[model samples]
Target: MTGTVTCEPGTPGVPGTVGTSGTPGAPGTPVVRRNRRATRPAPAGVDPRPSQHALTSRASEDRPEGWGDASASKQVSSYDAELQRDKPPHWG
Candidate 1:
């Protein structure tokens, strides 16, 4: 013969594996999903700059001046990785 074990639900405002009211999908209880991205910080020693995310950093400084979230503005539609490979470093 085989036997089965059942578990009871947890109290309100407290986290548990079972749903509210000792049943699954019960009312008056809401499932809260954590925002993993918002709570996480940038990896140690990893640059947070948008330019640092690029495959190549041509002449961009390790800590570029006036750096901000340039994700939308820094992108070049005419950028060619292969062509830029042979071009001389740009200096202004």
Candidate 2:
């Protein structure tokens, strides 16, 4: 009689295959190309910009340079990905 075996989902490689060693796209294979740039260190004295979460949080806030939350100032617009909650229609 014949039997069957199954490997766990998180198995490193194919259950019944041998692992091969060598660089990707060996001599006989085509070269791989990507549009990514290499990362480098930044200079001193300059501060890093705020992250997307921080920037979005500050932007969505209804407060302005010289305005208050309830000053009828616009916060966000209905066309934006995230709408300002509890604000007037003219705000966003």
Candidate 3:
């Protein structure tokens, strides 16, 4: 995202003939200045936060299709088991 300040044309200063003359009016087109934020990609070893749906999918990847028969507690344990056994420390 960027923040931009644009200068709009308004009344010009009174024309000066004595002493230091006032600067001329701005050009016909407005002046545009953009303040852009610096954006950098995450490092290779770092992991982005996963969505809830993604977490659920990874947790259940090893389960059978009709896993509804399993008790809720069993399902949770299986999911944790899969993550523990399959994922390395750096994965997260």
Candidate 4:
């Protein structure tokens, strides 16, 4: 005889066919378990760190105006100037 076992969501247990000894089937079968973590609030005075977006915005505000755009343009222009400088005079 052949049979299939199924489990429901959020149910923590193993699903398998019952053997002749009245015990669950082989240990190779998969089992579902609950996450036993504490959900209690933090201790009295601790503060969670700032979130990623908040930290990023704070860093951006600390930078000089137009710093990102200016840096990117400077990189491109410097690369182009270097390439031009390396070329033979006759190739210009």
lDDT of 2 at 27: 31
Q: RMSD per prediction, one decimal?
A: 15.9, 16.0, 14.4, 12.1
Worst 10-residue stretch by lDDT in candidate 3?
14-23
Residue ranges of candidate 2 with Cα displaced over 4 Å: 1-28, 34-39, 52-92
Question: lDDT for each of the candidates?
Answer: 0.49, 0.42, 0.47, 0.49
lDDT of 4 at 26: 37
Model 4 lDDT vs. the true structure?
Answer: 0.49
**TM-score computed on alpha carbons, candidate 4:** 0.21
Tell me the tens digit of each residue's lDDT in model 2 across 1-92: 12333333333543322222243332332234444668766568744553533443444345554344334555545645243556688887
Model 3: CA > 4 A from native = 1-25, 48-53, 57-92
Which residue pairs does candidate 3 place in steric collision? none
Per residue, candidate 3 scores C-alpha lDDT tens digits across 29-86 of 3333455569788788865544433443534646653565455465466777786789
Query: Per-residue CA lDDT of candidate 4, range 37-75, in tens?
Result: 678766768544434334334456455544644443354
Worst 10 residues of 2 by lDDT: 16-25
Go through the candidates in order and give the clash count of each. 0, 3, 0, 0
Ranking by lDDT: 1, 4, 3, 2
Higher-lDDT candidate of 1 and 2: 1
lDDT of 1: 0.49
Error of 2 at 40 (Å): 3.5
